[model samples]
Target chain A: MSSTWLAEAFAVFGKDWRSEMRARHSVATLVLFALTTLIIASLALGPIGASPGERSEVVAALLWILLLFAAAAGLPRAFVHEEESRTAAALRLAARPSAVFAGKLLWVASLLAALEAIATPLAVALFDLEVASPLGLLAALAGGGLGLAAATTVLAAIVAQGRGATTLFAALAFPLLVPLAVLAVAATRSALLGGEAGPVLLQLLLYDGSIVVAGFLLFPVIWNP
Target chain B: MRATSLSFSGVSRRFGRVAVLRGAAGEVAAGGLLAVRGPNGSGKSTLLRCLAGLLAIERGEIRAREEGRELATADRRRRIGFLAPDLALYEELSVAENVELFARLRGVAPEPGLAIARRFALPAGRPWGALSSGMRQRLRWAWALLHAPRLLLLDEPFQNLDAEGEATARALLDEHLASGGLAVAASPVSLPLPRITGELDLAR
Candidate 1:
C-alpha cells in the first residue's frame, strides 16, 4: 500500500472505529453472538468422538457461518458517516474517493479482525476440533477476516446512500459474497484438518487483492455526487 | 483563470430516452449573481446537480476555471458550494458536531460559535433536518461556506422564507457577493432585491 493509501484508510476508518469503540456495539454484539453460536455448535455437534474429518468439515462450515453473520451485522453503518451527516459529501469534496475507500477498508478490516479474535478460539474449544497448524488458523483468520471486511465495506458504501439501505445492503451483498464464502470456508477447513496453508493463503491474498482493486475502481463511481 | 465562474457549454443530459436538459448553457462570473428561471419539470435542479458533479453530463462539458486551468466535474465541485433542495444532514450528530465534521473533512480548522448562548447562535443543539426551514437553511449555508467555496449554487434558496426571511436571505447573498464570489440561484420568480448579473431562462 502507498503512504496515502494507509493515511486515507486510517482517516476514514478512524471515524467509525472511534465511534464503535465508544459505542462498543460492534465488539459487544459480535462477541455475544459468537458465544451463543459456539454453545449451539458445541451442543449440536456433540461428543467430540466423531470422525475428525467430519468434525473438521462441520466445524469449519459452522465457524464460517457464525463469523459471516457477525461481520455482516456490523455492515449497516459502513459508510453511514458520510451518508448520515453530509460528511460523506464533504469527504468527497475534501479528498479523492480512492482515499475514502482505503480508509473504509481499514475500519471494516479492524472490526472484522476483532470479531475473528473472539470467534476463532471459541470455535476450536466449542467444537473439540484440532487446529492442524495453529499458525494456519492464524493466517486463515488474519487474511480471511480482513478480506471479509474490505469486500463488505465496499458493498456497505454502495448501499449506504440508497433509499432502503439496510435491506438492499443484504440483497446486494449476498451474490457478491459467494466467492468469499467459498474461499473462507476452504481455508478454514484446511486449517482444521491439518493441511498446508501456503496455497490457501495465496487464494485468500488473491481474493483480497481482487476486492481492493474492484473497490478502488468502483467506489468513487458510487460514492460521489 | 478568474476567481470564480461556472460555464456549461452545449451541456445536455438524459436518462435513457428521458431528457432532463438539452443544449443548456450559461455563465455566472465572479461577483456576478445569476438566477436561473424555470417552472417545475424544467430541469433547473438537474442543471445544478450537473454543475455540482452530483449528476453526470451526457453530451457537453462543464468548465469552471481552476487556478488558471478549466476543470470539470469533481474539480469544479471542490471550489463550488452546492445546496440541494434534498439536503443531506447527519442527524445523529449535534449541530456543531455536524458542522465540525464537514469542516474537518475539508481539512480545515475548527471554529466554535458558542454552544452555550441560546438565541440567534449557530444551530448547535437541534438534530439535522429537525429544525425550522430558516435554521436548516442557515446550516446548509454554513456547510457549503465552511470551506470558503468560490462558486455557490442555491436551488430554491428562498423556498420557505417569509417577508423578513426573504430580506435576510437576500442580505446573505449580498454579503457573499461583496467578497468577490459567484452565485447562481434557481428560482420560480424574481425577487425585488438587487445584484442579479444575469438570468438563464430555462422555461424556453
Candidate 2:
C-alpha cells in the first residue's frame, strides 16, 4: 500500500477510536450480548458434564453462535453511525474510499478483538470448557475475528442506506458468513479436543484472506452510493 | 494556493421519477462567488452536491480548472471544499480533534484556529455535541477553509448565525475571494459577500 493510503487509514482509525472511547456504546452492547447468550446457554446445560467429544462439539457451536449474533448487533454501527450523523459526506470529501474501508476494517477488527478477549474467557469459565491446543485456538480466534470484521464492514455499508438497518444487518450477514462460521467451528472443535488443527486453520486463513481482498476491492463501489 | 474554476453544462439529476435539477448549468472562475437561489425543494442543494461530487449527474458533465488549466474529472474532489447542512462533525470528538482529523485525512496541515475560535467564542476542548447551533456552524466554516481550498461549495452557508457571526462569515468569504478562490453558495436571500458576480436561479 502507498504511504498516503496508510496515513489516511490510520487517521480514520484514530478518529474512530477516539469517538468510540468517549461513547463506549457499541463495544458495551456487543460484550453484553455475548455474555448474556453465554450465561443462558450455561444455565440451560446445567451440571451436564458430557464426554470430551460431546462437550467440544456443543461448546464450539455455542461459541460461534454467540459471536455471530454479537457481531451482527454491534458491527453495523461503524457505517450506520456515519450515515445517520451525516459524517459520511465529510469522510467522502476528505479521504479516498479505499482508505475509509481500511480504517473501518481496522476499527471493526479491534472491536472484535476486544469482544473475543472478554467473551472467550467467560465462556470457558462458565461452561467448564477446555482447549487442548492453546496455540491452535488463538490462531483460530484471530482468523475468525479478521473474517468477521472484513465481511461485516462492507455489508454494514450496504444496509446502512436502507431502513430497519439493524434487523437487515443480521439477515444479510448470516448468509455471507456461513462458510467462515462453519470453518471457525470446525477449527475450534479440533483445538478443544486435541485434534490436529493445521488443515482447518489453513482453510479458515484462506477464507479470511479471500473475503478481506474482496471487501477491499468492492467497498469503493458500495461506499459511493 | 492556485486559482480554480468550476463549470457544468446541461447538467441534470433525478431522484426516482422526479427530476431535481434539469439542464441547469453555470460557472465560477477564480475570485468569484456564484450565489444560487431557489424556492424550497427547488434543487439548489442538489445542484451544489452535484458540483461537490457527492451526487452524480445523470445527463451532463461537471469540470474543474486550476490556474486557468482544465483538470480531469477524477481530480476534482480533492481540489474542492464543501460545507452543507448535512455535512457534520463527530459529536464525540473535541473541536480540536475534529479539525486535526479532517486536516490529516486531506494530507494538509491543520489550520491554526485559535484566533478564529476566539472570534467565534468557541471552546476548543468541548465536544461538538455540546456546542450551540451558531457555534457549530462557525466550526464548520473554520474547517471548510482549513486547507485553503481552490473551490468551495456551500449549501445554506448562513444557516444559523447571528449578526456578528454573519459578519465574520462575510469577511472570511470576502478574503477567500480576494485571494483568488472560487465559491458557490445556495441561499434563499442574497449572501452578504460583496463579490457575488453571478446568480443561478433554480426557482425558474
Candidate 3:
C-alpha cells in the first residue's frame, strides 16, 4: 500500500526502530562507542586553537571513521535480520527492491542522525572545543549523516558477504569515503575557526550528494541479490 | 491464467564445462507436483535452483510469466518459493519469531502464519539453531508455505521427517496442490502424486 519511496523507507525505518527497542542493542552501543571515541579524540588532539580547517579536518575524519565502523557493525545486523530468517526471499516475493532500499536507507539515516546528535555534545565536552557557529556545525552534520548513512548501508551489504567482514568493511570504505572525509574535516574547521565555511561545505555537499544518489540507485541490486 | 511457467530450449548448463543439466527439457505443469531425482552431482539441486531463478541457466532461455504472457524471463520468479540445504535461518530468533519475520518480509497475513506455526508445534521460545533437524524441516516447510507461492521449489522437503512428520508434510503439500498450488520437490522418496506427471531421473 505504501507506493512512494519515502513511505516505504519510513516503513523499513519503523521496523528497525521497533526492533532496536526490543533488542536494546543498536542505539545504546552506537552512543556509547561514539562517546568513547570522543574521549580518545580529545586526549589525542589536546587543547589546540589550530586553524578552523585543522580542527574540522580532525573532527570530520574521526567522526566518519567511527561512523564507518558503526555502520559496518550495524548494517550487517540489519540485513542478517532478513537472511537468517530466510525472509530475504520472502521480501523479494512481495516488495520491490526500491522499497526495500528505501526502508533500509531511512533506517540507517535515522540511526546515523541519532548517533551524531548524541556524539556532538559529547565531542564538544570531551575535546574542550568551541563551535564558531553552532548552527552551521549542526547543519553540516545533517547533510553528512544522511550521505554517510546511505553510502555505508549499501557498502556494508556487499562487504557483509565477505569473510570477517569487519576488516573488509574498513578496507572497502576508506577509498570511497576520501572525498567526504576531506570535505567534512575542512568544513568543520572553517565553521569552528570563524572563516568562510561556504567553499568547504560546497565540496562536502557534492560528496554527500553523489554518494546519496549512488546509494539510492544501486541499493536494490544488493537487496535482491 | 494457467499459473506461471518455465521452458528451456536445448537448455544445457555447465559449471566450467562440467555439465549438470545437459539439454534436459521438461515442463512443470502448473497446479502439479514435479519430483526431480538424481544422485550426488546429478544436478537435481542445480535444476531446482535454475527453475527458481537462483542459478542462472547457462545455455537456455528461461521464460517466466510477465504481464500474463510467458515472456521467457521476467518476474514470475516472485511466485516461486525456493529452499536449499545450505539456506540458513536466523540463529538468535525463536522459531515463531523467525517465521514471523519471514512473513513480515513476504508481507503475508500474520494470522494464517500463526495458524501454520501452531500446526507444526513450533515452539515460540525455541531458537532456530537449537532445533532438531525434523523441527527445522517443519519450520522451513512453514516458511515456504506461508507466502502461498504459485510454485514451491524444494530441495528435500522430506529429508528429516519422521513417519508422522512425513505424513503431515505430505498432507500440507497435498492440500496446497489440491487447492491448485504447484510443488516441484527434489527427493529420493517415491511421493504418491497423480502418477508422476513430470519427473527428471538424474541418478545416472
Using DockQ, give the best candidate's number.
2
Clash pairs of candidate 1? A9-A102, A9-A103, A82-A88, A84-B90, A85-B90, A225-B54
Question: Model 2, range B60-151, lDDT digits (tens) per residue?
Answer: 98888887677664456656778887778999987888887887887776655445656676798998899888889988888788777878
Clashing pairs in 2: none
For residues A196-219, what per-residue lDDT tens digits would candidate 2 score against the true structure?
889999999998889989998998
Q: Which structure among the candidates has the greatest TM-score?
A: 2
Whole-model lDDT for model 1 versus the true structure?
0.73
lDDT tens digits, residue span A78-109, model 1 = 67646765556556655567877887788778
Clashing pairs in 3: A9-A102, A52-A189, A56-A185, A56-A189, A57-A185, A84-B89, A84-B90, B63-B72
Native-to-model Cα distance after best TM-score fit, residue A173 in candidate 2, in Å: 1.8
- Per-residue lDDT for A217 in model 3? 82
Q: How many collisions per candidate? A: 6, 0, 8
> What TM-score, computed on C-alpha atoms, does each candidate reach?
0.82, 0.95, 0.82
Q: TM-score for the first chain of model 3?
A: 0.84
- The CAPRI quality class of candidate 3 comes to acceptable
lDDT tens digits by residue: candidate 3, A117-164:
787777666655678888778767876777677677777666644466
Which residues of candidate 2, in runs, are more than 4 Å off? A1-3, B1-3, B72-74, B113-115
Interface RMSD of 3: 4.7
DockQ of each: 0.24, 0.57, 0.25
Ranking by lDDT: 2, 1, 3
Worst 10 residues of 3 chain B by lDDT: B65-74
